[model samples]
Target chain A: MLRKLFKFHGGVKPQTNKTESTTQPIAQVPLPDRLVIPLHQAVGGHPRPLVAPGDKVFKGQRIGGADGSLSSAVHASTSGIVHDVVPALMPHTSGLTTLSVIIEPDGEDRWGELDKVNYRRTPPDELRDFLRDAGVVGLGGAVFPSYAKLKPGKEGRLKTLVINGAECEPFITCDDLLMRERAADMLKGIVAMRHMLQAEEVLIGIEDNKPEAVAAVQAAIAASGQSGIEAVAIPTRYPAGGAKQLIRVLTGIEVPHGRRSTDFGVQCFNVGTAYSIYEALELGRPLISRVVTVAGNVDRPRNYEVLIGTPMDHVVRQSGARPDSDRYIMGGPMMGVRLPAFGVPVVKATNCILVGSPALFPPPPPEMPCIRCGECAKACPADLAPFEMYWFSRSKNFGKAQEYHLFDCIECGCCSFVCPSHIPLVDYFRFSKSEIWARERDKEASDAARDRFEFKNFRQEREKQEKAEKLAAKAAATREKVAAEGQAGTTSAAAETPDVAAKPAAPSAEDTKRALIAAAMEKARQQKAQVAPKNTEQLSTETQADIAAIEARRAAAATPPTPDA
Target chain B: MLTALLVMTAVALVLGALLGYASLKFKVEGDPLVEKIDAILPQTQCGQCGFPGCRPYATAIASGEADINQCPPGGEEGIRKLADLLGREFKSLSEEHGVEKPKSVAVIDENTCIGCTLCIQACPVDAIVGAAKQLHTVVAGECTGCELCVAPCPVDCIAMEPIVDTLDTWKWRYPVIQIKQAA
Candidate 1:
């Protein structure tokens, strides 16, 4: 029976370049001398380190524990001695470093204790916790923690569960190969997921181009004899594998901005995530390795089941890449980031390592100013007005850009792929998003400072008011005491003489001022007396005679003035 | 005409009574202008604005008693924000208060500290944490770098250190024009 499929708004068909890697079966690469695993493998908080340096770790021992609900734990790829936990370069477009744990493989490949739980007997919440501890996350580019998506929706039960096998990005075929080889394991994982979500049905959406994967999954479903679990081949497009896009293609439901698919009684997960879930519950294994497609500028391109934290340089060399390869990208050409260095680790999210040469991938042409072309808008999968957002982002008017729903853009590179003017539209959008986030962080800091400052001010004012009120009350009490004493004195005086009682209660202002002036004069007089003529007492006789002569002349002059008056 | 005039007076009286009652029922309080001004002022409460605190300074600015440039803790950016809020021309920060400097927090050298309470009394925000005649330490998070306690310390143990940016506080800088190098 044919099921009706739905189409998304806009997409561009880039050359797949997947045949080079898909011709051969998936191979395994030898372990390196060391592995550098970054604590932050998922999209949320960085996991805390569990095993410190110099500790013995097994091949599948939990090394990094999940920080919170939004984070996923990380396990050791192989048995080794913990080398050092330090800051090392990560596979990111920003070329930044984060906390990473280095391990020296002991070559023993020892396995730790494993406890496989029966899914039928385990509760849903406990199973989700088990998956989280097993380090299960979406391997379809986003790498979101899988346990977070297994919960029921607001309606108390999921209506449909869409398993994404749509390897739509060009030059990425790891998902296709995974489904073809391990379709039964993938099916078992889907059944567990369906049981956990209690969904009415399960729809595995695969792109039509991968006919082999589709057939294998169909066979797995038939062998299992599961009801309500069907395979639906979707149209091959650039981003049909996007969670929202795949959800739409499978269920014909359009998830709006700021709303989740669960709100509509649906949830989507990558097929690789389901396979990891199955491995965790069935084999009691943690996510230690994944199938990574190594292509581009390599003589022998193929997919390898590479261990997590294996350096990208070793993987590229094993794939027979030429020494002249100028750059390396971590994902497909459409949404991949240029790796800063090949020494960065192969994280859980790394699905492809595309070696780049000048001939294979040339530098883009000089960016030209936008000419108000509507090409980008038409190619935008989210149906956003890319041109308007571009104008605002260029001017740094993020407020206006947000009004045009800038956050809704998935940064799929479709707009940049179709722009006539060769404008790097996605770069501008990324820049805008980071800038907005930075500004929001700054606003929060300022607001906190303001609150603290305001509280300080309020506290000071209350203290001052309390102090003033206390002083006022004390002054009132003192005045009352003084008045009562004065009243008692008057009554006693009246007993002695009535006339003395008729006098005023306090001294007049004139008398007080006169007395104060007199006291000041007396103080001045006392101070003058205290200062005696020091050297005059020891003067010689000659000096005293000379002083007497000068005094006599002064007295004669004063006498003449007195006679004239 | 007389009857119509009496009827009009009666209606006016009833409406006036209703309006008076509504005014008393829904009385709006608080000065929104002061709140707006306070939001613009960096709330250092350093008393650099000649007022007791940021609230008083905001009130003074709103009432036209204080200039926007009187806040040194806010610096020139603060003046610009205040000017924009009040529709006044921006001016350089007033030197009477102090010169603008990078944000700093006070740190007391515990070994050199003599357990004197002078610094504690001088602190405006009471950011110092200690007891009388006991070793006092500055709460780095709460210290606004007012430098009021610096002069009061007899041992001169308090040091104003500039805040350092770490990875958590780091942000992506604005894009710079890149000139391609010769390959």
Candidate 2:
């Protein structure tokens, strides 16, 4: 059936460049001598290493335990002996190192105990936990943990489930080939996901450009006899495969940033993620390998079922990488980051290892100033003024850039592709977005510091106040004791010497104290009056000023009463 | 005409009096300016500004008792923010107090610590943990690198280690492309 599709704003039509890899079927790569798997392969917290050096790990064994629900577990691709967990260079644009586990494959190909559950029989929460342990994550480049997004919305049931198989980016055909060949397996996973969401309707939206994948899904749905599940064809457009855009096309419901599609009675997942869900729930197998496409600057561009932590150079070599290939990109050219080097191991987010050569992907023409041609704004899929944000971002005016919603940009390279000035508009947006995040982190740290400092000051003040109050109470008790003793002494004196008692209490502590203070004050006052004037009379004006300053400081100190007083 | 003008003035005076009463009834006390200034100051509480803490220094700045350049930890960028907030000209950092350095946290040499509680007592944020005559350690995330603990440690055990860039902290640099040069 033909479904009415909604259009997302401002997408560019770049060459698909996907036919080169999709023509071939997915093949497996031989296990390398070693693997360096980073613990942080997803969006959330890094998983804790579950194995230590000198430990034997079985195939599909959990090597890194998920930190929480937001983090997915990590498994050893094949049976191996743990070599050491150390900081190794990661596949990020920053070229920084993170904690990774190194393993030397023993070639045993052994499986440890499996923890598989019936996806339908188990409760939803328990099933989600199982998937998390199985290391099922979105393989559509976002690498979000799939289990975290599996729940129903506030309505307690989903209205529609959208399975993403668009593969809209140029030169990335991993999902396309996966859907074309493994449609039945993906259908099983889709059914499990539908059960988890309890969705009323299921629609698998594949780009019309890939008629083969669409036909395969339709055939699988028909064979399964699931009338509720339908495959819909979406128009071929750049970024049409984005979760929000795909949801909009399938259901005509626009899901904004900071909002879940489930809230709008719909949720979406990548076809690869659904396939992993099937393998995890049905076959009792954990996710350890994925389909990665090696394209661009390679003699034989193809797709391979690459193991996690298999080095990129090793995979590119399998595809006959040309000598001119100077740079390696991690994902599709549109949104993929340039790998620091080819040596960084393929992570969960590696959908394509796009090798770049100067001949195939020339250095960008030197950037000319933006012409205000409005071409970038027209190509921006997020409906933002890319030129206006470009000005703010270039000027380091992050506040203004935020006002323009700079983060809404998905960095799909659509604007940069369409820009007449060749400004590398996407790079500016990335820089601005990172700067904003860094500033926010600094702000949080400073706020935390302020809270701690204020709390410490408050604590110290309270302690001082408590000590002062205790001293005051003690002094009051002593004053009462002295008063009682003085009264008795005054009576005894009065009784013994009538003349002295008639005048005043003599030889009492109170009387003596009062007399000493009064006499001391009188003497000091007289000496001050006598000596102050004499000293000032001979002193220079500068000395007099110094005296006045000292007097002011003394006055300031004298205002607060002493605890003893 | 005179009677009409007199009645108009009477009504205006009555409304003015009512507005004044309302303002007094609902007026907020205390200088919010001090709070605004305090929010701009980094709360390291190193006392390099000759004040007890950041709050006291903020209060002094708000009242014009202290200059805006005294905080070295805040650096020139912070001074710019302060100048923008207070509508003053940006001045160079006051050198007599200290110089701005990279963000760092203190690390304690446990071998040389001698179980002294000096660093623990010196930490303004209580980032240091351990009781008297025990092994003291600094919580890296909570530390502000104020360097107050360094001087107080008799064994000279505490050292400030500058934070290095990691995947989590790395940022994209501004683009520098030359189109004309390429031509």
Candidate 3:
């Protein structure tokens, strides 16, 4: 029911190309003979293997345990024999391999014992642990741990829990179809999350483009007769599914930078995530499988609730992907990743797999030089000066590039899409960010080295100072004894200038003390001077301001040349 | 007063004319060479070329300061781009710009690192962590993988390992060609 306001900054209206697949219902694909399950499927630390090689694992059994707080556990998608625990090629931009558990599935899909919990009466902590065990994470492409995201802060005050039904990415309508068909299950999941967060209200934001899905969710809400839960339809926009963007569109409150939406009295979960959560908590099912959209250039483009760790080739073949059509993408065209080959497995984050020929969606245009047309700048949603970033990026002046608010860029690919030159603007930004991080890493290492050197120097100085103090004290005692002897001799034979004899010894201790103080002062000065450059954090801050000033000057200086029109 | 004003105006006009003429006469040929040089740079925004982006880097290359081998994203194509920009012969992607490894972030093997924090301090982007004698970790989002940490690691725990390529990291490589075939 929220009215959309505020014109969003630079974006291109790419062809939705979704109708080709949205009409078709999800179809099942035959399981693969071999499944290569990468340990780090979701966005966190890689899961460590709980079962060694040669272990007989049942379908949906926990084979890989959670490795870190940010990671999730992995379950066997099919009953299989663990063939090997070794490095396997994963589907990523890096094209590198990591540790994976390869399972050679037995003919039968034998089920494992399920661990269902009664959420109505169960404690939230126990439910959280249960969800973790189920490997329930955000199925909205980010693959973030759902339990970790639902955990409330120390203040324990959570306001609105926003269910993100806004599947803005084009050609990926699994969420849309799910809501239309499985609205009841999706709603049940929402209630479970509501209890988990102790949130006051539950707001479901569905994009108006999916009118049927919205109507279905509304009917479901009405049937449940749920209080404090309402479905609000938002306008269709690219990246409208982003937590911050969706929050602003629905609630009119911007999620501040580097802060979670939860900080602003709001929490977000995808429609798919809700369903997954429902299955995990109610059905006692672990996230051993997911819904995938196999669309584009295939004879039949449809959604499938396939078992996780299924190979791409098998899924595509089942979906009727033509053999002549080899180009395959893992997500939506706007921001989806392209796999090098079809051998990669379908991981948790993968929602849409496109197998297309050149005719349906043509390859990107040949890139030309950025002519400073300012179209990219117009397209940047972050209000950054992309042309200048282009300039600085071209120059390898990362410090200045950052000064221009490079980090603020969400890498939405709008600039690249809108560029007259077909410039890969996002690529430049990614490179700069990577370079900045690398430099930061290097500086940290050097600082650590310097600290060790300084600590050693400090220790050495302290040791010298202690040694000199001990020697001086010993000399003083010797002098005191000599004085006593001289006094006794004077009584006996009227001898000696005792004061003159002790004068040389007295100044030595005082001189040594003065020398130690000088050394300490020099050390302090060195430390201060050396520490100045090491404070690289300030470099980002100062450069940011300088970039702002440069942008201001550019705005004032630039007057558009009279067009020939 | 009228005659004096007339004389002043005449002299000013003559001086202005002379100055304008001299300005043009002394002006060195402002070069279009930089643009041509920039055209040769591998347009991949990977800054291994040491320049922020391709154009400014092209300018430096035109001036004959930057090495040709620095671009990894451009790989051979970028070297060719740089070569085209400089009107120089193309060469292989420099091994030092780092091999055409799939893009990866540096991960610190925390256990082996001596907490010397050398990698942390050496990071120009401040991506590494751990205090004196404490374990240091890389903020993955902030790491650039310039290989600046590799040399600084006293214990050699910091590795320039490529991020395991997942469907997430994969991007459609520039297609060999773009032509519309009627479906």
TM-scores vs. true structure, each candidate: 0.77, 0.85, 0.65
RMSD of each: 15.9, 13.3, 16.9
Docking class of 3: incorrect
Prediction-by-prediction clash tally: 0, 0, 64
True contacts kept of 1: 0.09
Model 3, A1-565: lDDT tens per residue? 4445444555556666677677877777788899888888877777889888999999889988887777788999999899998887777656677778889999698989987889979877777777877898888888998878887756686888989988887788888888988999899999888988888888888877889899999999999988889888877777777776777777777766677777778999988899989998889888888888888888888888888888887888877887668577888877777676778888888888878678876656776667898988877766778889977876778889989988888877778778887767777887777767765754564344334433543554676567656665665666668777774434233223334444553454325433443443344346557986676456787787887789877876696644641
Candidate 1 clashing pairs? none
Error of 1 at A437 (Å): 2.0
Model 2, span A202-307: residue lDDT tens:
9898999999999999999999999689999899998999998888888888877777777799999999999989999999999988999999999889999998
Residues A286-375 of candidate 1: C-alpha lDDT, one tens digit per residue = 999999999998998889999999999898888888978998999999999888898899999999999999989886666677888888
**Residue A82 C-alpha lDDT in model 1:** 94
Candidate 2, residue A244: how far the Cα is off, in Å:
0.7
What DockQ does each candidate score versus the true complex, computed on alpha carbons? 0.15, 0.31, 0.04
- Candidate rank order under lDDT: 2, 1, 3
* Among all candidates shown, the one with the greatest DockQ: 2
